[model samples]
Target: MSIQRELIETLQLNLIKHKVILLFGARQTGKTTLLKKLLTSDDDVLWLNGDESDVRLMLQNQTSAGLRAFIGAKKTVIIDEAQRIEDIGLTIKLIHDNYPEIKIIATGSSAFELKNKTNEPLTGRKLEFKLFQFSTKELVNHHGLLNENRLLQHRMIFGYYPDIVNNLGDETELLKNLADSYLFKDILMLDGIKKPEKLIKLLQALAFQVGSQVSYNEIGTLVGLDSKTIEKYVDLLEQSFVIFKLNSFSRNLRNELKFSRKIYFYDNGIRNAVINNFSPLAIRQDTGMLWENYLVSERMKRNHYDKNYCNSFFWRTKAQQEVDYLEEKNGKLFAYEFKWNSKKNAKITKTFTSNYPEAEINIITPENYLDFVL
Candidate 1:
């Protein structure tokens, strides 16, 4: 069954106005599926896959006339894996500048390649959107709140990837294949990495350290690589959308842990796959970490879909006082503490409240997390 994506309407509206629309996400996140849904039978569409040698050659033509000749009279042009094509940014720029009548949609799984190629050339000519693993809102919208509540633990363990969400059998096997295949595809395909095993080792170290500050030096020691390599691999992981990093929040307090950052996986299933663990929450020692990661990732998806502008961070001081999530938006601070156990009391740090008396603090648990994320 196909679920409607939140970005479909926005994308349809953008197509009418923007010369080019770039949809970015990790592999197997249903970008192509969404694009197919957006296209109708009457629409004059030219679909091209950048992975095809001939398609890349046709699009790589630098001249506007060359691109125009290839596009012909197509009203809408869709390119899958656009980042794989050489000079794609310049090619898209040429198409938009010369053939303003043609609407373009480009999908890419690798931000490192696409952003570097597209940023400057298509600066004013493009609208960009990020598609994440299915969000809580999407699931609830399609399956109802009652079903969502029943499947919460399954989501936390197997994650909300489109394939895994739609399939009912062997979630652990599916996630393991996804982790080994698509999850590391971008990193393995990229150049300058002599030892790919180091990347896997780094990810394994990070999988265990979710919800906590990560030290590059410590990870390097665990992975048997140097700090510089660890940092590069971590950056690649973030760029590939396998994980995200949250820096500490500080307002110049000397005791604030400003330099450290926490790492969280984009999906819990991928995280568990990294460590080869899929035991139920009750039997797992890392349930708290899973809960924290799930809430943060869902919040991120909500913010993206809603187009909410905010800066996010984890707050902690040298004294070890902490808040799991901190969001700065509209000149105000909203702090959140994540609790898997509803019995736990939510408390703001004395240091945080004293320094920023205007900020608001709240607790996010399973009982009320939908309000915050959805």
Candidate 2:
């Protein structure tokens, strides 16, 4: 039931140098478990939960003595649910300024809260990492028994949640409950969101619209919310790691559908739950949606952990020609298309190639997608 996070190696190296590491991800993605595994060797590791009263009191007090009293001489401090404590940014700043030797690792589910509170204060002091549900690579390496085909098949059904993997009984119901209890609770309570039902409607709409161009007006009408509210909700969901928006990639801008963006759920398991339709893969209608979401999320996790700060998007044209994923990095473009079948005939657009002649194109099929994303 243990997954050896490769980020542990990166964390060990970062702690030897950096003052802080901010870990953020969706709920139940195993942020605490990863930190627990990392802090096992450090005898002085101090764990603080923002939900606890004593921990909140210590974090709110700005005095250097209070900070020192809480931190003590611990070489490493692990803060769980850091967003729960108000003014945690200043607290982290105080610790970073006063105790340069102390290495801090903080995790939170809400990036909007975490980043807004800490990004400016810990600008130069913090290294950020996004923990995601188990990736195919991690699952393969850790379990040592998942065949590629079987993994792909299971992924389309149960998804890659840590708890879902650990407790293999009725994963559909388990994931549905987790999504409701974790993601639903966190995202619905955001500021100024008076009605949480709209958020649920928006998520359901997005779940069905995977890999398709999304219209704000259409979404607003369908969800019974305004365009501005729809935009805000989408941003909140992205911040909370519930869904992702991928823009259309263009260079020359001719015949490119630049205004339209494609949306994908961060986890297929949750998407199914949101829609309340966990159909078996044998009779499922949205296999393409599952594949697209799984591939994009896996690549996102790999790039995030590897610290590859590349721009990612989808490519499509007026003629309905499209590429599933586009990665832009270091002045070059890489185009990718995801297909469940090993069909070699991907409708590459003339505009895409002409504008970015140096770009390379690859087809990601079930058999070889791991090398493309992982």
Candidate 3:
């Protein structure tokens, strides 16, 4: 892979002026791969990892002078897995303040750990980039972006993780390994939840209910836990990048369906893996779930990497009128419905049209979506 152009270009754009660049994502999203690509030109780059004992010792020295000495006179210094080091926030702050010219890049797996340590101290001094798995656009550079038919079919089956794309082995086994080894490990270690079994159970239930209103009380009842604990565990999963929550889009008090949010997996492959459902495109029962997840993931990448900041939501009413995604940008709201078929079945509701007369409503199908998203 000749390095996704977006990350390379983003590194070049942010590295020169910013004192600290923080890169974070789920495990195996290729943080190390992207950082190493950025290191190609500089011979003076210093790399330190908290996984190493000596680096942890140097970080915890409590003296700014020792930390400065460790940073040395390199033009660029990278701390991989910065969350493993104690007082990493103040240590990076020391280098950033004293050596204004030196550039620093740090990588972490979880946002909760990384942001808690770095966000407050490095305010206005840092640029954050999230390295997600291969986007439809990134995949386009290599294999060319998928067409409507193939994209919809493959997305539900194989998902967008980097290793899964490159592995070319049994996808079923690959997803299983990812869920068992990577996703579960982070949850157990970070949240101190002893039962990996319960997490798997919760996720499996979620897999069946994608794009539908999720009832935490019902989920707790099914999984044999209280609703509050279910919410906490779901938050933990979201923070770890295991799943993403889409809140209901509500502007009018009359028709808005409050207190009901839809959840989608960050990676459909992991979702399938947890549920142990590797049925081929022709035989799958959850094709709708797959389609919804693929669209949301693609849109998310466009929003993040392309710097298209917009408020996104799903719209529905008490009477069950719905739109899959609602985007608000530039004082205009845009409603979109994702359908696998190009045949149009979208109907704009009178209440929605009356509420936001300025907003545009359009159906995004396999044919015309690339022009909008890519």
Give all TM-scores, in the order shown: 0.96, 0.93, 0.92
Candidate 1 local lDDT, 1-374, one digit each (tens) = 98989989988888789568999999889998998889975448889998799998888766888777777778899999999998899998888888888888999988888888999999888888899989999989998999998998898998989999998787888898999897566668865567888888888999999999899999898899999988887887787889999999998898999898999999998999999999999999999999999999999999989989899999998888998999999989999999999997777878888999999989888898888988
**295 in model 2: Cα distance from truth in Å?**
1.4
lDDT of 2: 0.83
At residue 304, give the lDDT of candidate 3: 88
lDDT of 2 by residue, 1-374 (tens): 78798688887787787568999888888888898887786678888888698888878867877888767778888889898888999888988898888888889988998998998888888888778888877877876544644767777777888888778668888987888887678777777577788888888899989989999999999989999989988888888888888888776577888777988887888888888877777798888888888888888888887778899999888888777889999988888878886765765577677777888988788878878666
* Pairwise TM-score winner, candidates 1 and 2: 1
Q: For residues 1-374, could you state the per-residue lDDT of candidate 3 as single tens digits?
A: 45374777888877888569988888888888888887885568888887798888878745667756776768888998888787788888888887787888988887877888998889888888888887778777777655433554666677878877776656778788888887777668874466677877899899899888889999999998889888988887887788889889886578689778989888888888887887886777777678778788778888888889988888889898888888888878998777766675766777777777887988777677776557
Candidate order by lDDT, decreasing, is: 1, 2, 3
By lDDT, who's the top model here? 1
In candidate 3, how many Å is residue 28 off?
A: 0.9
Lowest summed lDDT across 10 adjacent residues in model 3 is found at 144-153
Kindly give the stretch of ten consecutive residues in candidate 1 with the minimal lDDT sum.
Answer: 183-192
Residue 108 in model 3: lDDT: 85
Worst 10 residues of 2 by lDDT: 143-152
